[model samples]
Target: MTTYPKQALLLALAAATVAAGLTATAAPAVARPAATAVPRLDWKPCATPGGPAAQECAVLPVPLDYDDPDGRQIHVAVSRVLSDRPAARRGTLAVIPGGPGGSGVQRLAQKGAALQRELAGAYDLVAFDPRGVGASTTARCGLAPEDRYLTSLRSWPGPDGEITDNTARSRRTAEACARNGGPELRSFTTANQVRDLDRLREALGERRLSAWGTSYGAYVAAQYAQKFPRRTDRWVLDSTGDPDPQRVARGWLANMSRGADERFPDFAAWAAHPDRDRDGLRLAARPEEVEPLVVALAARLDREPRPSTTPGVPLTGNGLRQAVQNALYGDTAFPGLARLVTTAQDPAGTPALPPELAQPLRDEDAAVMIGVICNDAAWPHASADAYRSAVRKDRARYPLTAGMPVNVLPCSFWKTAPEDAPTRITDRGPSNILMVQSRRDPATPLFGALEMREALGGRARMVTVEQGGHGLYLGNGNACGDRAVTDFLTTGRRPTEDTHCAN
Candidate 1:
């Protein structure tokens, strides 16, 4: 499988809306002081292919550390597609992107039209590039190019699930970030993102901001809601993961094993179907046999790696395992994975590595992925023996992930502790939250979403889409799921209780 920062990739695999109306959610009467003087955004025409022609972009300046507002500052790139009908505009709707590395401004470009169409002219669609991401102030770890490969960044265990090399890499990566990341890298925590968001709200001069957050973005949005509950209007969390304050990003990583297990059946059925025969991609005669076939093939590759389309970067057993894990994120990736498996199974055929796996990630991308996860909370300083034991057990329980989900990461060797404890999500907020999740998301999973729901207590309602993918709303094309979320965003109405949508 392709490697990126494990947490970011986990979030990327796991990855809308708003509405308007009447009074929006009433903000608390308390007068809250702005962290700093909110600057005027000089919005200018910024158009991209398929993006709104009227989309405007600007930069919002925010402190690198909220505690030290007068210290240093950085700019967050912001974009907005203003409501076409200003007379009907309700408020600003923020589209939070997944991945510690996901570019929110780009996401606005990608999804702005659909959002506008879905909600009519009710709200201004807006998003931003968080610090260390695209079009914003960026920081790099000065990592060697070789160390930036997805496989290199993700803690994929040794061929036998041993974690010796993984431990060494973790130490090396942590040291590199310490050496070159500077304070900006240290500032890339979820808390800072929330602070940046609040600054965005203040800059927009909106008393309340509605938002749609997906994957890791859901966690950020949840934190925003927790810290500044009354500042939110309609909130939509898509494909949420567990927000256990204790585990934080670590829990999200570990949950992927279950996610993979939950989603594999869907792929197995597809790969075994007769349709695959026409494409010469069928792996087995039956769905039951697909797992074993893949398992056996992975083991064979482990023993003797196969040459790949990328010279000198042959496909390893772990590479195949990563491919399988990534392919489970969406149905569209099924064919590429099926073909890769078939090619790897061929003794004389060369397998083509997925594009993500074929090249190393950029230094900034790697830095942002590692920065957010590590900065969010402290990872356990488990001994090498502990990591080995965990990997062995996880590999046995979740072979599709091959222990990667539970494997050690650079966070394990992070020198700095989290500045603040992970924000505990709670029911103390407004009851305006709507969560839409896929039943078999290979990154977030249904069980994790349940944990988030339980965390929110009575403050939220969930729409369980009976699907086998990562994202919902405007993704996967599930009419039932889409309608439920759109209805909530556009009309401020939610299911009275938890509901399920048919596939």
Candidate 2:
């Protein structure tokens, strides 16, 4: 799983740009001859299944740090699928995967087919794993196996809002990372990712690169555009995030409070519907009753966490809330949460977390989530007390998330400060950017994505999908929103102003 600060910042910025229409030049031309004249990309087999098409994999060398260009170099994993129809081809467009830890290689596997199908071979689709990711110069924080659990890693509070245990745990986790995470762990900053992207563009031999960045990748794409405005072609940012420069990931974490509140209604309405009849999972007769039921159940769990299917792993109230939040990303996962809730409420039935929850996370995934935020910016130290106070307030205001949204994480106890300063995105980028977002996202809330849009200034136009959940484009099935982005990328046409996509 990936953390969402960058996503929120990018999404928020995209929303505002779409609303303002400050940079739009023309309504994209559907029959542009430029799209047809671009060269084809050569595809190669990737180390991973979902990476590039079977024929396009290569290693691009980059500096460990841009300031030390001649220093020890690292390799970034890259892949591409060339445009099959040159008559319809545009330019090369890189796909930026989400997760401060998400794999560009994996994203290509999952979304590549859809993109190829949609754009009519308008551009060669390309992607790469940032350094310290799969096939790249990987990093390991050497976290303890127990600390690797999702619940523990996220820094949930104790049963009764106690901070003593959480603080100690956080410190211990931080210490382990400091001790085990070597140079590679320290190297996982968004700034570094942006630099790596520029290097990738150079290696691809493209003078001006087009890109589609999703979630956290959007921040990277935005940063790259800002850094090299003249080098950018058409750019698309999907499911963006808050661009709160000071807070960065911290702000993204805090926004979860409002995000959960905004999106829970959709879940509640689903859980209460007559369709729940066959599953016997409905929590309430009316949609309004769902909120109270969830809150009360979580409170009960807080007092007495239930024994879970996994040994030594109990389902605490916060854990339940976390599971719910993750489920809200897409409609398919709703049933899993609904099942867990039903089983938890019923005495005879057994509650089981999804396999991803029950099993320990991969070391790489843990390191990504841990290393990125801590490396991106500094977090307060020993912030358990602050977290408790905030969580309590958040619980009252956003019952869907309980108090977990405002809780502390290992970053608070991280042993070191950021190696470099956070990169400030300025309006120094090309005006060839388009953004798409959902109006009510559970992770990257609309308000936060707005801040990012404001920061982008005249560089972008945003398309807001009047929908819910995390990702917006193909992920949300919003035709208008998806078309707006696809059209922009394939033909460089943007809405004159911010536009909305109806459900």
Candidate 3:
């Protein structure tokens, strides 16, 4: 799967549009009467099991098209666990999730305990599935199971970096989605997701909402803040993407090129360390040698695919490298890659797909990965040519990725033109935004996050952790950065300027 960044420039651009009276969002069109009362909600029991006892679930009705509010309506499944310490409660903080297909209900369950502990009942934790996702009204393209595999879903280029096959697959996938997905699929754009979030805010009757968004979710939170700045209290965007509207998700995928380059050194160092002998997975005697060794291994795999534990499938060098990149995002995944590398080098035995890599991806997972990119923006139909160029150049510059960073995907063949145009983010509303990022993230690079910081103008300050990984805050063990974010969320305080966290 691919990862993207978060940025603030989107807010600035969005604000300019609001001031021009070109369009207005966030605030409801109906003005409030004098002596307005604080909104109250009637909480009911939620549907998900193992959720907090106080958690409530509700189905929120939203327009399939805001301009056509009277048209078809969709149900956005929402959940919330109210503050246990009611007196200490500040306001509500929505945990906007990453994948267009990711279930917010599940996100709340996963992060709920930690968030409740850290924030100390300071805010109600809320989450929701975007329209056309789980528990919400959904759309299906009826894609075949084989086409849903991780490698297939991502549109990895052919053995020689040729994308001719990728082109056909992209076209086929796009056509299937278009033919079967119906109106729901058309409503899956970033703009629609932003609008749905606003509707959720209205339903909750909150004047403002704090948020902690990670990975792709970071962009959604940033977009919401841009569209409704006054409605945002303290916004924390973790693991951001470039705010270049023209590129959007396309740029996010391309960013893997630089991200891989920045993060590979860490792996190389780890693999080359003398201590590696203790683990027996060392590939090189020196850190610098690890890169070339990996590159050569991948080339050898490309020239000769070997039988794997899965009968019909072989672990191509690209597959091995992909597993490596995904594993590098966290320390827990390291052994799987080490095992694969060790097994591959064994002359007496053939390697198998690591258990983590063995199980085929679920359709929902594939849907989210493919849908987000296809829905966010339009990719080049000549994406194959682009991939060819990217892989050839990326392979030379960052061989650890072996041209995979520049590979084509379903977006190239996605039959639908973007159902909606990309939203222009302006610095239109409240300046209550905080962004945190790792210095050396493999998926969303630091340089790209900076572009987002630059875009936010004076509306935001960034906290940079001089660490490595795809996620920050709770994902990494950086107390300094995590504390800074928690402080802002709980107390409305922020650093006077952009700050850095030490290793």
Q: Write the per-residue lDDT of candidate 2 for residues 165-238, one digit (tens) a residue.
A: 66777777678778887777788889888877777776677898898887777777877887788989998887
Q: After superposing candidate 2, which stretches have Cα over 4 Å from the reference?
A: 1-44, 47-55, 382-384
Error of 2 at 184 (Å): 1.0
Winning candidate number (TM-score): 1
**What lDDT does the true structure give each of the candidates?**
0.81, 0.71, 0.69
The lDDT leader among the candidates is 1
TM-score of each: 0.93, 0.88, 0.86
Model 3 — TM-score against the truth?
A: 0.86
What are the per-residue Cα lDDT tens digits for candidate 3 across 190-289?
7887887877787788888889887677888888888788888899888888978888877876787778788878877888888888888888888998
Per-candidate clashes, comma-separated: 4, 31, 22
- Which rank order by TM-score, best down to worst? 1, 2, 3
Off by over 4 Å in 1: 1-35
For candidate 1, lDDT tens digit of each residue in 1-503?
A: 01112124433441111001111122112223334666678788888889888888887877877788876767778889999989878899999887877777767777888888988899999998778776677788888877776676777787879788778888999999999999999999899899889888989999999999878888889999999999999999988989999998899889988888989999999999999888898888999999988888888888899989898888988788878877777788899999999888878888999866776767777888889899899889988888888899999998877888888889988989899888899889899999999898888889999999998989999999887887677876388888988888888999999999988
Q: Residue 108 in model 2: shift from native, Å? A: 0.3
